[model samples]
Target: MNFAEKYLSIRKHTEQLCGPLQTEDYVVQPVADVSPPKWHLGHTTWFFETFILKPFSSNYQIYNEDYNFVFNSYYETVGNRVIRTDRGNLSRPSVSDIYQYRSYVDEAMVKFLSNEIKDDVNELLVLGFNHEQQHQELLLTDIKYILGNNPLFPVYSEFKSEILNLPSAAQKLLNIQAGVYEIGFNGDGFCFDNELNRHKVYLNDFAISSSLVSNHDFIEFIADGGYSNFNFWHAEGWDWVKSNHIKAPMYWHKIDGKWFNYTLQGLKPVNDEHSVTHISYYEAYAYASWKGMRLPTEFEWEIAAKHFNWGERWEWTESAYLPYPGFSKAPGAIGEYNGKFMVNQKVLRGASIATPEAHSRITYRNFFHPHLRWQYTGIRLAK
Candidate 1:
């Protein structure tokens, strides 16, 4: 994809997510987990302007020099930024005003990409695009969480998940003979800061489940006192269970007679065919242990993903999210993307239904604290 097309397409996807949102919905910032919609719009623009535009364009000028402080998300070396927690306080640049800022950025970015930018700018531009795509997903998830928390249980958009009957009878697990396999991105395309410095990784003989663990499978576990059974949980998992009193994954609310999961499109009857998301690594580990299975290491997941379209749902892996071998922090602010979270986080493979297709890829590694279930997280079994 050329510069304008790819950039504009990503911009459209971000805008589309906001299209269904109300003005009131844009400003609800509930803790660090959920960023205001206006923040996402401004922050993504900051990524491009700071990384690609200013460095590459000799004559580039920031739309608002003050915005560099307001929206510079964690780029320590780049300069001071607005304190993260106070993001909700910047109410002056209203959601509508932020949209105008995005448009202003679009004009400048298009002009830069169309002519004056050097060919070397292409790679960084792709990185900026992928970075924006990541924020787009975050925008949806954060918005959904914020809206769902409203007493009335407002939905940002329709949760239109179609339960498809995969040709179950025809589907069979494909055995990829174990060997040393190269994991991580080596392709000449856009990938995140995490999937870099590609190299070889060894794997043992292992079998991946034909599909992700389903909602039905999870329900059975819950029905069998999965949450109450201490034997099935790790010490940490048990502690988490008791501390939070988590009966089930977040969003799986038990109504009068049955369970319903809140989704982006809205609340829907839990579909058994869909991968059971919102599962934590703690719960996923317990479920795997109960079934005599394990979560695949990042290496195993990447090897298997070589043969699939990376699936519609991201599969949780046993791998703790970490930087690749010989990984070095990127100079300046861009370094914050992946280097910081190299510990105490697990890797997730594949992508979710809400994830943009352009952003999905095999080597993509998503990481979060083991306790976070708000993202579209699920499990794939290994043995």
Candidate 2:
């Protein structure tokens, strides 16, 4: 597909992901971490207008002046906007309005891309699509969080996530030799600025698990008082567990001594064969400690990923999200995109099933607070 086709395909898929949502479903935010589905539609459209159309397209009209305040996320260089937590309270820009906003931007974007454009303009356009794809994954997760937390336990759709089926062959750890390994995105294809300035890092010999930790394995940890014992948890992690009274993974329920979890399809028995997901970094770390192992560093993960199959879940790593050795940010609002969030966040590698195609690479860096588990997060052990 040409650039225009690729752009159209991404936009259409975003709408399709929202196809199952009812009018009311699009408005509710179950948790602060998950924005309302409607907000995603508007926010993604806002990105294009704010970054691409307004600057690049000649005489390109802004969709809605007020949208800048309503949809801008953490871009301080841009104008002020709604606080992240209050996103759910918004109702004036109704679902209908949000879709219209998307249409308005789509019409302008399609026209802009149809004509010859400069490389710089095309670069931002590609960044916009990639940005939208990131939100595409968030849309599903936020929708899941919304529906899963509801008392009604409504199903988002009848579609069930495909379960990963790793062979029963002996799960041996792939041993990576200690040496200097080049890391980060070095390709000519489009990549985020954070991935640039690839450099070499010396790594000690380490072994990574062949497959992700299964639900059965986590259940075993739970059964052995993994939660009750604070030894397995970090200082803040134990505090979080105790404060929230978290006894099991999010969405898990034990009734009649049978374990079940909420899925996109609805409440169902926890599949022991499937890799455990919806786990926070704290849980991943504690689980690793419980097994006398540790989560791999991002460097270890990127270097060793070639030997094993991933992409089943966003695997948590021990590395904190920080700028690379020689990393530098571009000027203006784009600079604020990633460089600012380098503090107090853990890095995750690989991609989840919900992640858009071609959106993830070996160098892709996913980060969140250690306590946030609304995404499809899982664990991989290392030593």
Candidate 3:
């Protein structure tokens, strides 16, 4: 797909991913865990509108003047946003009106992009498309967190995922020989700044799980006292786990001696073979330790992942998330994308089934606070 087709297709697919939601669902922010659906909708648009549209289109007009205040997200370069906790409280553009606003912006963007947008901006445009795609994923995950809070436990969308099993269990560990390998996206095409300036790294011989740690494996971790036992956790991870009293992964509830999980299709029996997701770093680390394993370092993961399918599934690595060697942030508003996240985070590799096929790649650096699990974060074990 060329620039415009790729842009519209991805943008439209993002909208379709939202599925059916009642008016109230659009504004939900039950805990600090999630951004409201409306916020994501407007934020993605705000990206293209603010970065590409406003900068290039002389006649471009913002749909909502207050949006930059309400939906600026974390772009300090652009400006601070209204109090993040109160995003749901800004009821000015009722949910329906937000759709109208999106339509208006879409119309304006189509005209501006079709007529005057140049080939030189293709990279920036692709970056904007990917930025929106990331938010599109967050839109699903955030709403999943939000919907899970309701007593009704509503599904974010009606579509149920059909679990795909690997050809074999991939139960056995595969040992990767020590070698020097190039890790990070090659800039063969459009990629986030975080995955740039491809570099080389040396890896010792190591074994990584062929598949992600399954729910059944995690249950075994719990049965082995992985969470309750303090020895398996790090100092801060122990404190985090204790403070949260996290008995299991998020969306998992123990009832009448059975474990259940909330999904986009609603609460259902836990599928043990499906990769255990929505797990915090502490939990993942603890589980790894319990299995006589250590989390793969960032270099190890990126190096190893480059050998696998790019976007199939995101793998959790042992790396303490940080910037790569000789890494330099791209100048301008877009540079804010990955540089800000270099501190105090854990690295995750691989994409989820929920991830858009186009947006994921091996070098994509996904980081999160060690305790946050609302994203489609999952772990693969190694020793």
Full-model lDDT for every candidate: 0.80, 0.91, 0.77
- The pairs that clash in candidate 3 are 295-318, 296-318, 313-351, 314-349, 314-350, 314-351, 315-349, 315-350
TM-score of each predicted structure versus truth: 0.93, 0.98, 0.94
> How many Å off is the CA of 316 in candidate 3?
2.2
Which residue runs of candidate 2 sit more than 4 Å off their true CA positions? 162-169
lDDT by residue for model 2 (225-334), tens: 99999999999999999999998998999979999999998988999988899999999999999999999999999999988888889999999999988888888999
In model 1, state the lDDT of residue 10.
91
Write the residue-wise lDDT of candidate 1 on 47-99 in tens digits: 88888777776687777788888888887788897788888877767887788
Off by over 4 Å in 3: 306-313
Number of the candidate with higher lDDT, 1 or 3: 1
Ranking by lDDT: 2, 1, 3
Instruction: Pick the winner on lDDT between candidates 1 and 2.
Output: 2
The most accurate candidate by TM-score is 2
Residue 248 accuracy (lDDT) in model 3: 86
**Alpha carbon lDDT at 153, candidate 3:** 91
Compose the digit string of candidate 3's lDDT tens values, residues 174-208. 77899898877785677776776678888889987
| Model 1 misplaced stretches (Cα beyond 4 Å) | 159-174, 306-309
- Give the count of colliding residue pairs in each prediction: 3, 0, 8
